[model samples]
Target chain A: MDKKKDILSLDEFSVEQINEFLIQTESFAEILKRDIKKVPALRGKTIINLFFEPSTRTKVSFEIAAKRLSADLINFNTSSSSLRKGESEIDTIKTINSMENDLIIIRHSDSGYINYFAKNVPVPVVNAGDGKHEHPTQALLDLYTIYKNFTNLKDLKIAIIGDILNSRVARSDIKLFNKMGMDVKVVAPSMLMPEDFSSFKTKFANNIDEVISDADVLYMLRMQFERQERKFYPSIKEYNKFLSLDMARFNLMKKDAILMHPGPVNRGIEISGEVMDIETLNKDKIKINAQISNGVAVRMALLYYALS
Target chain B: MREKATVLNSDDIERIIKRISHEIIERNKGSENIIFIGIQKRGVPLAKRIKENIESLYSSEIKLGKLDISFYRDDINEKIKSDVNITEIPFEIKGKDIILVDDVLFTGRTIRAAMDAIMDFGRPKSIQLVVLIDRGHRELPIRADYVGKNLPTSLNEFVEVKLNETDNEDKVSICWI
Candidate 1:
């Protein structure tokens, strides 16, 4: 019998398990402050970072997390792998699985590929990201960043603004944050948010200013024009006019509210350049860099939990 | 359930703490250059108790810290989530006489890991071990410098130390099946 679980979906975890992971991640964060950051937690273990999709932030942070834990890593990306030579995704995955890999951190463009791999593969699998379905690790890192500021998540309000249609980060965040008892609001064009809402409760709005005043956290998603298989809006200019968080919208939100973006943010399309350019004053309002640091810690915790 | 018996109560625990505090001071010649770092969980309270005893007698604040050695463990079942505690060493450990405290000294693997973790901060002048219970074993060639009590037992037996700060009571017990 398989004794442990593969972290394929964030929604599969109970509230206690998620909280425990956060607590474990906090300990790793403390380790990052030491002069020597490496620890022997996952020594003698091998990891294969299988990324079928393009990613810099999540992939790089996972590499750093694995290396910091003293685990051996092999970066199996799409461009370098034999998949470029017309090999099937299954054959590619099975080829990697044939090796002595203890864990596989996979990022694929197709939704639910991780779930398929988790069933067929013998060793544990972590969903770094799987298409537009879920990006569990990114959501975890975002939660860790938000948790550092507000201890009481029960009463917090989060407004996720931008291209909700193409954002896997937004989907994962909405479900995970909702499960943790936070109120989530999605601000985007009507065509972006689906009618069913996938059984996850969230308030939807097309106007950014309507959701700004009550938000404790203004989470901005990138306007992924590259992922636009078909045009959701008339143009980028029209989308910016309706929902972009420019200077005027930034000032309208609560002054105490912090801004969060799962990186490669479409600078002027989703949020104003001024908002991202703002210098850190207090820790509560500090953004971006803090998220990156927390990303490494959260990933370390996830790897440690999945393998050891 | 398993067979268990308490060997040390609250008052006995207090007296042992005081004696260990005095032993630490006398061996180092003074508390000025001394730094106390406890292995997390039960060790934290014992370290704090000794620091208090030194402060009361010498009327000076001493450096006390805590170390979590979860990441350094060699034998752990990865199926379960490992319990991680905080390691807060505020001051630098360079050139300081460090006393590593723990509740029980069994196979000495924990002390070895704690020492390795502490060395990452800086090179200390020397490292000493203080344990409340010195259970006999031969897994590693290590020994405690100052011990509260020496209890020998069979391989099946295990020592359990409960501190008021963490466990809501002060006592030591031995458990065996």
Candidate 2:
């Protein structure tokens, strides 16, 4: 409803515009619950998923989201794409642009390559992930998950734990949660902390114990080992001692507090296997699975916002 | 928007609703298998009033539901003017006869979208439409089984249906937009 052309970043939208996407998400979420889980909203439209990086959940989520809306989608195979044959990135995109797709969703290892694609392409571009710059859709789905649990996001304390420096999810979540009036605090090892920490508006803590008791939402960012160029921590054993969510940390959390992760989770690094198992055994606290399911609905809302 | 004329005042709307209620009951032969589903916003109150009228006068109860057809709309390219409303179909509609209610019938696109939305839930035995007003500029081939008033107008004139539940007054007016 805000008439935004692209969804590259959450910073380009106002709070009301972001809330509008959430409101539309409510309608789309209901559609997924029905017996027939498809709509004709994006009928006959073509969507392209161009991922320059390897991903599992985000790629499949966007694919399912597009199909559920009755849109034709094609995933560009980076391994066999023209870029490997020494074609320029812009020229390769220009060749694809000649096909006249309705939208393009991209993920690249380069920090700001999505901006270049969005600038060069005529169609709307959605940033699935761009290095450590941002992953806006992941943040939106995370917001939707939190919104489903809590009545109001304002003043709700969210402690984002794990790798903050190399996590695009952490960067996007901090910006969005602060915009939604939530109290955000990043808890990570000093080595995992961002170099330009002063640029972030959220509070910083070196350990999770500082905010584990008070936070309404404990967001565990995935430790992006692939993104880190060098060793940020000494060992997983030492990392687990400082920041891993074991049973003791789980017990300290509030009764209604939700645990989240922009997933592909490290089983024994960010959270212990016992704690992860409690997610199914307990009262629906671990929102990792919900985050994945809501990922489809939230992406549906974003796709609708971009194309419609 | 400038008001052109008041088509139906408070009392006229009440009398029309009463007549339409009788018509719906007589046509269906009984209210035994009827479930009233209203389009969100103004249609919801009209459906509730008709359901209540049938309940009290005929001494039979009927279930009511609300539907929002925003997602099913065909006009995704164009901007939708209204805000999205909640769609609540609590009971099973598979074998029940559905009486779809709305405030006005103009382009018939809303009813088309609403029908597509209802089919997604389950197949009803039958779906009969009931509208308070028929403005008569149909792009789609849709018609209501029960009608309150048939006020024909030009394309420029907009039919405004106000109900006490949502708008604090029951009045039907035509305006130039």
Candidate 3:
């Protein structure tokens, strides 16, 4: 597939593509450590962050990535866009998309709508987070962080804990990590598990200790209380009792296994604060920060590779 | 059918590299603050050759670094997927006279990207470009500081540099359709 046209999902990415991206991201990560964190790769180009959903982390990282690449940027959140005045989503996006802009980073609440925008627009489209469908960039940054730690992705055991039915990050991560040859498994209650688990090289478990005893990486997805999915479990306390990453379960994990979460932790619900605080990654920083730091590099790689 | 011509033979390659090394020493005044940072593939061998020549001339050591400008290129973001190479600058470049070595100098964009990539490492006191062949058709305002051979060409022509370090041979050729 022509990734430069649009980076819509991880499914279209091959092992060569992912590895190439990770290698390129290593340079961007090194750039982040320098006194100057900007590059002139996309100087004459323009980028628009057309985020229909509210986001502080993803949107900010993308903005930083674009700015670092010297691309002209425009931020478009739904509340400030024409969609606030009863304008159709497609119409609002199309109206703002002119010949001046070179790329559009879109985040919408509707699944698979990125393809609609990519089809209608002539410029490149990057899927920031499209509903519960996929968050390709987030998945990429996560993979970068993990790849940096483990050095290799194949045959490694990755335990993805917490909400599975509603996390956009988990959706992309499963597809990508699997494509990279990792043994990925989901640990969630029956209600939180998706109806189909046979689509990829993934396993499902209703208990945490039963699945993570030998896991090399522990990835946590937020409980997604905001999605407000109905009565998955009796209560937060009960969910924590059964599935949360407490000290006991944490000890069961491989001593050097990485702890990762796409930030804004639930504190006491999906993962315990104590377990999440044990920082480990580049320069001894927490994995969450590492993930955030990596987001910029990975996005820079994507933007530079897609636009260069 | 296509037309082909041999530009520089193996012995010519060695002699030109030796001459370029001496010229670099003469211009940079003894190669004290200078380092050779090669572009990927063939540039590495050319840089190494220059380094060896300089080392033997004055019996002095000089550092060598490799700079890959794949992602830094302007056409890297096009529809086609290109191979990404690794950049290894083992030592610092700040305040030193830097010489960027490459095999071909046609569009000048690759060297432009290399200069930009070098800036990210640190501000080098000065930067110079050395090319084995300078087939003149520049899209940007760029000119090499040193050249082995200045071969003029049209837009449709391609310069092929084959060296022992990468391709299992030693020669420079030109192809035209």
Candidate 4:
């Protein structure tokens, strides 16, 4: 019932709580395997998905999760709402809260939007993603994928490559991985690196080779070229030269090193077509698609722990 | 002397369970074709205990199952908050004599809801209700076949049955509204 104790960061939960959440998630996973994959856990509860920016996977995944838990869901987009007609974010959220929503899952282009809204709202606020700030659930699912594979995170090396400054995924992953005792290294061009990266306790690598050697997991992030108003590089060819994960670089990685991508990838821009087709790097090899299923599990755990 | 409805202690509940186990064995002529199904949260552990007790007396194991009747409850509109731990029915139940166990039996609405939920699984040969405490004020004709203790009370009074399996305590008390 305490609204101030919301899950703003993965670090707020202790290892025991995390493990308990995972264990409960396993039960939900088992429940999902049934013919009728719905539970009455949140039957009468209402969840509102408010996305200021456009999204497909995160939006649908959350909708499916709510349905599976038997919670009534309402999805709002900027295009369909009065926000397009110059309505303020606070006014929109206030209107939704007045209608008796139990929870709100928000994705916004503005930084601190979710945090600010969470402070104002009485219901629990879940951050789906915020502008280059944090995507804690995505990071949790990513870490969950790694933990499922390696069985433990202690001392495991993970390399997050490409566009660190523009990636909310990278920021969240760095925080969660460090909290879980993983050795995290961020590989990005100096221009794309955040100025105060030292606070995250992550090692910076300008060269992928310096970090790829001992990595247990290689997380490739999609470059936000579409978001950049001006070109950050001379050309697409020049950008690929410094950042792309080609076949050669893929071969250099440890054989057991698992590959991960928060998708909607630019195929040849961030990752090579050859490397994407690699038997070990593909979805069939590591079952990264299962991470989508794990997203539901993790979210189910979060809702259950917070509301139940 | 006026008959007073007394509170049942933890030791009394345990003793009742032992007697119920003996009665089940004697009635069934052995634990064959018998299944113990507990209604959601509180009934689950109670069913397991009853099954364990039955197994100890008889060489063969008695099948145990759980029925979560939250979705089938008639008073769905009365629930203001969501319960995160949803019900899960784990096994098949067809043509089996089911002992539906619950912590307390009051107005019999929970039992009625449970019956509707169980019918979805398969046809049971028969269902015999069992409860730790039966506080009499039945709105429905539903009755427990095997009750640990029965207390005659007014409709305004509330009977709270606490079990160690769920509530972290094992006692039954009657409190006035």
Candidate 5:
């Protein structure tokens, strides 16, 4: 196995590396299905989750992944940490580094912060989410989820809908999908798109209607309501009309097409509330639950990959 | 790696497997309460062959499974030469006697990890090991119950077991890197 120091971004990974992680992820996923859902792979190793921003799924997912592998984990949140005491970021990290954790998982509000922090740290650093930079793990889990639905990812048409500009998930997903030979199409209103969208190497679309009939995967990205400084769209109704995956749009998608979201999904914004309901989510096409569950599996694969 | 010597040919491997299968059945009395588990890669084929041999000889059905010890390995990232294979042990092993199969047993770390991986599924009444090649250099206090050829080799030498199922040939050789 090639030694990967840190999982900072999907752009840094080759398609082969990504494919290896996805394959190893299936082995981990099998562990989750067993009665004893724990392994002693990383026994006695310590991992620390250092988050400067708020998160629910990503934080818990890492914690679960570490624990399932029988590794000690410490979660450090910004609200309770020494960051409030005017401690410098370097000092805080250096102080944590002194404890000699095997790996450091960080989620910072600033874009590209993890790259600099990873450079300073001796141990491997996994970027949980770094502003608008990247969420590589999310992309990995999404890829695994998609791979589960559609065996081969090569040449698969994946239409990523919503918040392309400020979405770190979108940035990571596009890079990963493109690397894996997927035909990626980003669908969002012009206001929510990045000016340098052409550099993303994905087909740009102003509406979801263009790809709804043919796309193999409908990846709905959560709108970064908090990240926006100004109004990107007119209103929720207007956003729903153009971007939201309503029943009409959902029915138009191919019978085998899968619906994906890097969750905490905005029900009415990116997808209709009915489509995301428990009954609808139970269907094979909707994979939100699988994504969340696969998140733990994928992270376990990654944690094992980095620290092993 | 350079091949040092051809320790066992295809016919030699076949004869050893037959002898081991007879030993396994004779020791266990019958295949009634026995289950065979193959450690991933080469072990799966060996286990299947043993199970088939016993079935054909005694006309009894024996449960077989494939175990991948990658996750249970102490050296997680180290020595992972191939991708993680699927571990499919469908049936229960709560009190059944398990015959753990492997192509070669060297430092005994792989067997140790295999044992740990098996325990995760269920507890067995007794776990006996079957190895085609037992290269002498025991890192842990582990031993195979049934052995094919006990070829003693130095630490620098490697024992390579090739099964017809995986390598398109049945042969065992000692190699030097």
Candidate 6:
């Protein structure tokens, strides 16, 4: 497929485009330092945030970014909308498009819902998060955060752990990390591993010992108990047996391995309470909170490039 | 390759300033709080000359400032080898009838970026652009409010403006290179 025409997936964006986007993002970074943080770049432009699932960070970050660019924002919650009354996904998006929105930022519960919506929507569609599919912006922000810290992406060994099967973040990060020529390893319980994961061409590890050893970055995804209809493991104790990132495991990992988690973290379930309490893990290396702010910068760059 | 030069001299510059000053006074109705902000390098000298002419004619001083729009420039990183002169603005420009003076108005990106930079100082009461030469073919939606000469040119051609105070000569030329 022609690269520019392949907007259905975020994987189509080349490394050059990502680099250019980062450089473009630096132009707007000065806006954050100002007292009245706003730019008139997208003035009078309308942006629709259509989130089918509940998200505080992604939704609010996008809203703030749109507002900062002076774009008119309309937020739609699927639970409260006609979607709850069984309105088809296409019908909902078409209805929103009819309002003459310049762009649509969507997060849905079903995987590939964003791809489906992007195919249907006339306006530029930004994938916020789609089921267990992909969250491109989050991954972009993740990359941006990493780039800000390290000033490089090539040759970095990043280990993505936890519920890989249900993580849209992991899916997007895996693609982006690989595309940027970084070495990636997915460490997760075998039950939570995707079947076609090898297509990503990254290493898979069932043991955390092998995965975390000499790793540059450790990206931990939250285990979604809500996604599994039946309990995947017998008990929280059983789940922790395979999944928990305890102090011992954390100590075994490389000293420079930056621990990260996309939050609403189950403190003791996936990562131990003591691990979360570690000053270096929580304060220094772990910059998941800072990632929320970087989302605006990345999204601003994306919107500017795709629209302007 | 011959070292060719076309002479405009100081007299030509004096004539342009005289014409521009008359136009400014006529439109502004007495230069009250009217300020001239030059877009670095050549524009600053041109602005200073215009301010001098306005002061001599009307017996009143027009507030003059200089703006170095390098930091606000979009092409700074892309065209890394390009030379950018020193920028200096002497006074606050808030709530003044600001006139951005540039030697030549071409693609308009410079003006657009300059306007973006100008907002950082403080909000101006009104901004009116005055250019020494308005060579058409604007990539951006920008226009000079007061133009000395409107020279229609193609995209490939270059418009050069030289001021005696800065360039050791005074001239406006269109070079086909």
Identify the leading candidate in terms of lDDT.
Answer: 2
* Candidate structures ordered by TM-score, highest first: 1, 2, 5, 3, 4, 6
Query: Per-residue alpha-carbon lDDT of model 1 for B1-177, expressed as tens digits?
Result: 364888899999999999999899999999999999999988988999999999999999988898999888777444333678878887889999999999999888898889888888899999999999998885888999999999997888878888899989998988885
Tens-digit lDDT track of model 5 for B1-177: 999999999999889889998998899888899999999999999999989999999999999999888777766545432367888887899999999999889889999999988888899999999999998888899999999999999999988889889999998899996
For every model in order, the TM-score on chain A comes to 0.95, 0.97, 0.94, 0.92, 0.96, 0.90
Candidate 5 residue lDDT tens string, A6-77: 989877777787787787788889889888999887888899998899999899999999999899999887
Native A-B interface contacts kept, per candidate: 0.58, 0.42, 0.19, 0.06, 0.53, 0.00
How close is every model to the real structure, measured as TM-score? 0.96, 0.96, 0.88, 0.75, 0.95, 0.70
Better of 1 and 6 by lDDT: 1
What would the per-residue lDDT of candidate 6 be over residues B1-177, giving only the tens digit for each residue?
Answer: 222344345676678789888888788777887898888778888889888889998898777777655445555324321223444444677788888899989889889978886787678888889898888888888888888878877676677777778778777777765
Candidate 3 chain B least-lDDT 10 residues: B76-85
What would the TM-score be for candidate 5 when compared with the true structure? 0.95
Q: Per lDDT, what order, best first?
A: 2, 5, 1, 3, 4, 6
How accurate locally, in lDDT, is each candidate? Answer: 0.86, 0.89, 0.83, 0.77, 0.89, 0.76
Distance from true position, residue B153, model 1, in Å?
A: 1.2
The DockQ-derived docking category for candidate 4 is incorrect
Stretches off by above 4 angstroms in model 4 are A1-19, A97-100, A119-122, A147-153, A207-213, A233-258, A269-285, A304-308, B1-46, B52-90, B93-142, B148-177
Docking class of 6: incorrect
Best by TM-score: 1
- lDDT: worst 10-residue window of model 1 chain A: A278-287
Model 6 lDDT per residue over A1-308, tens place: 11222234567778898887776666555556555577666766788888889999889989988887677999987778997898986787778878987788878788776777787777777778888888888888888878877777899999898888778889889999999999998888777888887787988887677776678888888988888766655677876776678888877776656777778789898788887776444555667676767778777667655554
C-alpha lDDT of residue A30 in model 1? 83
Give the winner by DockQ: 1
What's the distance in Å from true for residue B23, model 1? 0.8
Give the range where candidate 2 chain A is weakest over 10 consecutive residues by summed lDDT: A1-10
